[model samples]
Target: MTQSADEGFTTRQVHAGSDARAARPRALPIYMTAGFPFDGFDDAAAHFDQGDGFGYTRTGNPTVDAVERKIASLEGGAQALLVASGQAAVTVVLLGLVSAGEHIVCATHIYEGTRGLILDNLARLNIEVDFVDDVNDVAEWESKIRPTTRVLFAESIANARNDLLDIASIARVADGHGIPLVVDNTFATPYLLRPIEHGAAIVVHSASKFLAGQGSVLGGVIIDDGRFDAVRSGALYPHLTGTGRLGGSSLAERHGGLARIAYLRETVAPRLGPTPSPLNAFLVGQGLETLSLRVQRQSENALIVAEWLSTRPEVASVDYVGLPSHPHHALAGRYLARGNGSVFTFTLRGGIDEARSFVEALRVITHMTHLGDVRSLILHPGTTSHVRRTPEEREAHGVLPGTLRLSIGIEDSADLIADLSRGLDASHPPLETVEAVREESGALDVVVAA
Candidate 1:
């Protein structure tokens, strides 16, 4: 129905990118073509020079573009770009805007994989990243900002851990400095939280996760808010400021509102070489058809599971925005429309070893590194995802050795809770030993006590 112009999210999800015909297929057709056929020699030149409307798979694919357009409409973005993975989206976005000398102010609560990409992989490229606690007073973010600071990056719902960002407040801080606020909305997804509506300048997603609704595909999407003025800040973005080095012309000149995403597709995609496979894009497209339903079901199951975990004697604390006790509970209610999300973290009565044991003991929940799967999955961030970090670094981001990140699935809540209870029974350490350790530490004020 051509983006609906005015329709509910479910309606938009079903009809946004489809054109019904007299012979409408029940399922979305997979374009699955590597290159588009050109009209003529002049048409080929025009297509290559213009660099839009799909030339090659590396440049553009119809299936990927269809998904990108659908996501853009869903997230209220002017335009969007689909990439191989969420990490690629961030890399292209950063490289598109910031040069080697530039710096980024990122939240400490970011996903461990993203943290590694920014600090480890990107560091070798001369990119500097400064991480601040998402809950730190707003002044901390401002204090970290420097003359070379180019982007303010955060996660709408901090991955694994459920520390939620004050998006509007952060957006205001970013606006006062004339910077763009980039939010990784993977965990929240657009169904639960639309960051653009809250002043985020750009929204990125690991479409491999909840957006795909299953673990069958790997995809990423970057959606542009179209609010940043490239002309004014073009110096920080060379591909935007300079005469087109990658392509004939810079995206800033060709597509003003979509400058960043366009540049990412045409200029950076060729160099970064992180385009999603047509097969993966097709799977994600199928997942998008039922995104709302899966997200809602997952969220509801998560809330019940979080509550059950909190009541368990073997559980210490829960890190879910849905719970009233969480620090970001109120903010979550305001931002997340559907629910707080299926991925949440909790601590076992014991420490890291016990957390690992619990994961091993689980009967129903799969022990895996990935989240947002159709089947319930459990992970120990300290050992699995954040194993690269030292104990000090891990604690700085609120990941305790005993912390267990649970990605509650669409399974019945009762079955999920029973499965967790089995793990909890297996994981809790001796009560006397725990008490002795607490006494020896001589400080009960630690955030990890739970």
Candidate 2:
């Protein structure tokens, strides 16, 4: 059963897609099977012809379906599709919407994987991509939109830089040109900011992160706001409005507001075969129950840590939008009123050598590439996520030699601060050297050692 919008967020997260009258199970039961048995030939024919029941796991599963519905409700979207991974979700949505010779206007700051997907894979397929550096500038976004452009893509809050995209403003720009706005809301989850509510046509998530709070499983979801009218925008999406494998009826005619989801479910996902396991889906569903609690605590911990880092003499800058010093703090407050997200980056005054010492010196924080885990995770983006890009390209995205990205978790603020202090101490020169420098300056009475 689908939950209504009137229900509280936590209530909907717990109750959405749950059937109280059917099995009487408090937890959503995982349908662990490749295929469901048909009662008879008529049932099989109906299931195959009209897509009545779950014919195969590749197409759909009750467990995956429950998670999809839950995420869709949380995101305030008409429908959602669960894929194997976040990359798969992005791939499925773009493939479903665009084709060869088309183009997509994207924000310059985004995940490295997505950047690679657009620049390497999609470009190889003859699809062009133009990146706008300043997403906040309406003119910059509007200027890049060509007639072939079908989508405007950006992250709600970008990964390492903490640049907050003005969702409503960019959505307006997309709306003006009849293009759909697709936002990757992984950093600022639905609890922080629902892109659909801000006029975005579609929302995507790497459910592996905050959605599955423990970072135990990998999953992704694509949510459709149901505002992109394929029939109205038929020129841009001919595949959706035109006839295809679904007999004579078009997807728009068959599913109405749910045309994109129907098309993905019936054709794109199955054909691409990025099937999510039922067990992983069930785990992700369990994670969704505490989404708000975990994210809130993580955000709080992050803000405290960001403040502490700002005061440190060894730190050059903190890239958290929660901090007043950050350039996008005001914009973050406008769009992300719940809390500035936990995942952000900071840089040290010393270069890679200092960064290596800091990362290795941490006691509680885990050195890892993953984010949004229950345990605080940290990594250097220059040599890790952004290694493939040239030095100039890396600098353009703010991946400097001294830069390190941190994903704050639901840990005690004091303990996290102590661990960070330990790392900072290790990264800086010895106290003896500081004392010697103060003595040499003959200002030991006034100058405090680092």
Candidate 3:
């Protein structure tokens, strides 16, 4: 009833971890059981003491395992774990790595919920996070590393803003320091970029977005690449290296090739527990089937929209890595081999009011907080997603008052462009498309048509 990553992408998406019964219904069924039956006390002990397969929904379930395997295979990782929401995934992963007084280095352009998770929730647990601005500079990361630093985290393609992180550079830095590199590939997804292939040790995803491809489910997933030397670096990760908390089981022994995942499932997940419902997992798995097709169309439409926005006078600056004008465009060919993801940001010529008006004037795109759906969406991070941060902090991370993030979907390019054109005209009238004169501005407003 288990499938491996060696299968094709579409094939793995459809058939991975699915049994004959799955085909009988022609759909993934939800095993909505809270607990599994055991023959005797010893059987229950064997199931819990050592994972002798399925036991309980909280600990593990067949439905969860099916989706986990599918995602792991898709991401080219050794194992996977599913959780309730994107925040839950971040919380569980961070808690598993660093403890009280430990430190983690994260990129400044992380999602607002994740940034708040680091600032508020993890801080409550006494774990500290140092947000670094220069993600591409390995030396800058090296400067932040201290004896207490436990992990290096960044997003492959940021949520709302589109900037490509130099994964190989960051991974090299993490490798040099013997710390695991965690890349949140929520925006890029495995279809466009698998961080593990670029030397990342682990990959995290907000399955709610593109992986779900609909605004229905809220789920998250963590993929373990199974390459980190956790046991060798005992001094840094005591929770994994010198642990005797869970019935005297050493982290070194219990979690080895897929150790992080094993540790998460057996020890951390049980405590920080936010298990995904079988129904949600099934929904995500179903979404995974058309991931390539959906994202391809989305990316194509996104590039067209980014191009159209760049030509408009109402737009101040556009930032999508697919454009050759991006600072990270050179690395895009290396990192995102398949496609540049569909989420990106552009600032209006007018400030917050113009941005708000532009978003409100939109007709086709939904005015919502969510992304990666069959329909387009737009939001202003300064007021909505990143509202928790002060103006100073927002500016520090390139989040300006006029900035508008777009998550383009599979709609027709002309329709999307027309919808955006209507909004742009309403925001700043009497100005034509800045095609010729704006070329010398050198701001990142390149048109990425096709």
TM-score of 1: 0.87
Measured against the true structure, the TM-scores of the candidates, in listed sequence, are 0.87, 0.91, 0.88
Lowest summed lDDT across 10 adjacent residues in model 1 is found at 241-250
Clashing pairs in 2: none
The best candidate in terms of lDDT: 2
In candidate 3, how many Å is residue 64 off?
Answer: 0.8
Q: Kindly indicate the candidate among 1 and 3 with the higher lDDT.
A: 3
Each model's C-alpha lDDT?
0.82, 0.90, 0.84
Largest TM-score belongs to which candidate?
Answer: 2
Across 1-450, the per-residue lDDT of candidate 3 in tens digits comes to 477768779988876755545345667778888987787889988986778877789898888888999999999999999998887888888888888998999888888888888888889988888878867888888899988898999999875557789998899999888889999999998999988998999888889999999879999999998865765676776666665754576667666666667778777887877988899999999999999999999998988888888887778788899988778889899887778989998888778888877888999988899889989999898999878779998777667999988899998999999999889876776534554346645444444331
Candidate 1 per-residue C-alpha lDDT over 1-450 given as tens digits, one digit per residue, 9 for 90 to 100: 378567799988876876545565666667676777776788888887666466788788877878888899889888888899988888888777777878999998887778888888778889898988754359999999998888899998886568888899898888777778899999988888888998988999999998897898888889989865776767766666567544555567777767777777766877779979988988988888888898899999999999988988777789898999988888877888678899999987668788877888888899887788888888888877888889998877667878988898899888888888777666775678778888868666564676
Question: Model 3, poorest ten-residue lDDT window?
Answer: 441-450
TM-score of predicted structure 3: 0.88
The per-residue C-alpha lDDT of model 2 at residue 128 equals 97
Who is ahead in lDDT, 1 or 2? 2
Candidate 2, which segments miss by more than 4 Å at Cα?
Answer: 1-23, 431-450
Q: On a 0 to 1 TM-score scale, where does candidate 2 land against the true structure?
A: 0.91
